[model samples]
Target: MPHSLSWGARSIFKNRYEFKVRICYLVGEGRDLNFWTDPWHPDGPVDSQTSIGTMLSNIPRNVSVHDIRSDSDWKEVLNSGPYGELTQIVHSGLFTKELPSYPLVPWYSSLWFPGHLPRHCPVVWQAIQSRLSTKDRLFFLGSQRDSTCSLCRSEPETHHHLFLACSYSSWVWRFILLRFGYRRKPNNGLQKEEEWLRKTFKGKGQIARAIRIAFSATVSHLWKERNRRVFEEKSTHKQQTLKDILDIIKFKTLYLKLQDIPSEKNIRISNILGLPCFSKEKSSRHCTWDPPPEDMAKLNSDASLANDQGSIGGLIRGSTSNIMVMFSWNKAPETISELELEAILEGVKLARSMDIRKLWIETDSMNALQIITGKCNCPWRKKVTLKLLQDLLTSFEMWKVSHQWREANQPADYLSKHDCPLKGIKILPTTA
Candidate 1:
């Protein structure tokens, strides 16, 4: 190995004096060994295992393991305090066994999702977390401003009151709910409204696409309208605002080219909103969802990081484009690369669990795909991710993970961005 290496490579390894000292070695036939220097003890060496000075004692620096056996009597050389632990071990025939190396931590779960999960997902997620800059929050931060609802001006502005309790916003919400065919009035607060959003919108299907876009649009436009009223000193009428929200939701829903929405839902929303039939965008010739070959399944995975937290989501489809599984998880990692790698690994695990032997995996992360496919050199900092990719590769007889366009991976993208109500690994359409 030294002879074949270039000068720089050779120089790098030449000074590699630091080796792992964290291992405990098993005792074998200790024929050729140095007791003092070797890390063969279960407990680590004392005093750095250096040779004792001449003033200390006459025990030779190169004492062999067998040399200690000269005095076989239990009370003499063996029972001497220093060597007693080793004697007990030898008597019991429990010599050295090196502890196993640390494997990759298993805390990560992959979430695969599409780029447009919910339109402007980050903004809506912030709304859910009460991270938006409502007036009450600004006042708390020492702003010399009235902490009043921008729309209603009847109560102090807050995440909950602005989105839920204000009379003007309530009218808008009631109108949209009526259009959504929601018969019962909304519950009294924001959390309940959020629960409704989750129940109505989350799934890997066409109906899910419609509701998710509407939900995201409502959050976004409401925030935008509030900002306009406060910052621009202008406000649109409630009817005009509704039209804007509808147009935005319609634009998003149109691009998805949803094929599976029930006709009754289509009629109800369209009739109520007084809009044309949902427009359909042509799928790109080069970038569109494609199924794997017969007798195989394709797994598409994606991940997103929001507010210093990470999540993963994925979709598995048969050759006919029938979804067999979809999954998502909220993760604590703060980086996109780790989340992306985790999503792919979890997709692989999902397929294996389904007994799907042949597979084609798709991800929208170029960096992650490159690392997994060996198209580029792995960075030293990504060693943990690289190990995980290696483990994933070895698990399937016929499998491939490739980078696909975000345009083609909508379901996975949606899942990565949307917080799933379920925990851990989940299959889709789960019963309550």
Candidate 2:
């Protein structure tokens, strides 16, 4: 809203609400997010979902997510009116489900994949939609006097000619394809070129990614060059433009985790871009459960989510590998990592109640392990629970946490997927 703000900035500010509804916020530390108006919850804004009139009346409208983190904080609000409903949603978890998805479009992956350059998308998307303000489109609308192509003045400047068929753009496209080791000529029209791209780059491999990036970059630069000639009356040699496209592809490839595909063409492209291809080892190593030390008890925990409901399970085994105790509990809808952490927390509590002092914890969720070991940032909603878990770990005489592959953690995984009551923890007998 500043006077110095550009028109585009002001326009974005004006439509901020439209953007807000479409996006979800992670209530990390709750410092920045507004509790009432923000779509931090999966269901949408808190103000729109429930009646918070009498209960939240005394609370400030501008209360932040951080303000309601504690039980004591919510206690006052929950006592009065419909605010109690909000607590049920809050304690469950905050995760974004995809807003209603659109029908699968063939060009979606080509335009918007991991590591795609953002600046190239808008231009390429316009080209794909045949909506670019090329000379033909402007002439048809009576806004431009000439329908001639800006890049190659001899041809009509339609989407097909401007993007693909024109001599200038065709040369740039051919150069890019040649550099990527494709010796064939490009299809003439935009429609045919799109079909070819769809059939060719419909893969998750490194070469497909590179080709897609190069295609978009090529289209974007060609359009920019056309605009420069039409408006600014400036021109760059097609070789320089081709070099710019190559540089763009190489720069994008730098951030990608390229894999060694062991193909001659892939190698040639890799060598051209200076991309390092890693040979991932595919070992057929066996995995099995290992018993704990004579004095230590090992706990394996797992979680499952289905139909918007979550369940957690854990197994505690003594040094002899005998199941000391096993538990299955249904919980409010939560992410797998949160459920795994909860299962570990509950298992530790169970062990503590049994007077077990030495404990070893194992879970299949590396994310939970990272958060527990301070290797990653803990979500705002998990801070208090994690603090309690840390306190519990300190109470043990000797404790350790480690990650186990899902294959080796099948017992806990089974317990998590086991049918159990919706309310309380189901403690199963060791024999059963």
Candidate 3:
């Protein structure tokens, strides 16, 4: 009230403890007076004739002085405090005037204000709550017990049960922990779970991001699996859930690792070879199979790109139309040359698998075929295609390259597009 106190006076009391004391002094004495500590007023008294005086007399001075001052100068004192630095003051009720209709007691008393949740956590939180609320309503609408697990139909379906505590959730968490090499048991409480994740992944590279992605993916997958079980009476398996986690981890690892490679050559090599450039020092094993007769071994390869996924499928065949060896691999590549290199690698891998003593390799990619046979050298394509040819040379006694029209490569094309199974290969198959 004393002209709202000058900015200088307020600035001088910037130390929180000092500002609190000044607020108490101002509330008790306005500008012209001082507090009276006498028997008529067991507590301290403000000015003699006002409602504020009566209110001040009722509040026990033995109580926290800060609390008393906060109640009296709620708006002015809080406004003077730093915006996000007033958590203690706000929690002490100094800013309740700004939050009308909010509960008198703080919902989460230990939580700090300006409440910065993890990035995107509020969206996740609301999505989780909305899903739980929907499940609750659905249960009640069916005249069923609102407490039953929607997925298992065997236990209460609170957020903890659905996500962490129930038998179904236990399996889901076990799958996640095993994939991450963690051995901790999953807990039901949200805070406990969050703490476990934070402590376990602290200082691990990209692991915290992986954990968050896995957690969110688990939430989404489990919700979908639960809905499937409830609506379609479908059963979800632990193995399938584990597969989902691994698949997500693999995809995220590849995506983030590729982002770090600056050179187009290294990226193309990674996409075509499915191996990181840094991993070139590591040993790789190739499959070897019995070669067909010298005049009969004919290798066919095809590459196809779709918006969602790309693949190269190839096979070696004999003059009698007997398939000698076949290979198919899915690759995540952005460019046509990457796809072509992937196809050539598939051919080389197939040639190795068949142990083709004499080989006539055919491809729909004429440029790739030209590079492989050394008729041309595309500086861009040479590094990867040369690597493939080098690997192929190690297994075959003789090899020739021929360019075929895309339409002529029907078997590999059909297999690339539809995964048509090959027949008549006597050699044992091997995993890549």
Q: What's the lDDT for residue 375 in model 1?
A: 80
**Candidate 3 runs further than 4 Å off:** 1-123, 127-131, 134-147, 257-432
Worst 10 residues of 3 by lDDT: 107-116
- Model 1: ten consecutive residues of lowest lDDT: 106-115
Best of the two (1, 3) by lDDT? 1
Candidate 2 per-residue lDDT, tens place, 8-101, comes to 9999999997887787455655668787777776567778764544446566789887777663245455555544545333334532334666
Provide the overall lDDT of each model, using Cα atoms, as 2-decimal numbers. 0.70, 0.81, 0.56
**TM-scores for every candidate against the unseen true structure:** 0.39, 0.48, 0.32
Q: Model 2, which residues run further than 4 Å from truth? A: 1-6, 13-101, 277-432
lDDT by residue (276-338, candidate 3, tens digit) is 344223245443233345465877777778876777777778766677666666666546556
TM-score of 1: 0.39
In lDDT terms, how accurate is model 2? 0.81
Which rank order by lDDT, best down to worst? 2, 1, 3
* Tens digit per residue, CA lDDT, model 1, 1-432: 559999998876776533335655555555565655665555444225344222224556787555545443232544544555552345654456466577642211101223254446666777767898899888999983799888987899888888757777777778877777776555466556766666665665444555555666677778889999998999889898888777765665554544444577766676665545553445555677878899989989889887776889988998888888988888876568768888887888778878888889888889888878778776776677678667766877788777799888889999898766546567765435
Top-lDDT candidate index? 2
Q: Candidate 2, after superposition: displacement of residue 223 in Å?
A: 0.6
* TM match of model 2 to true structure: 0.48
**Residue 328, candidate 2: how far off, in angstroms?**
34
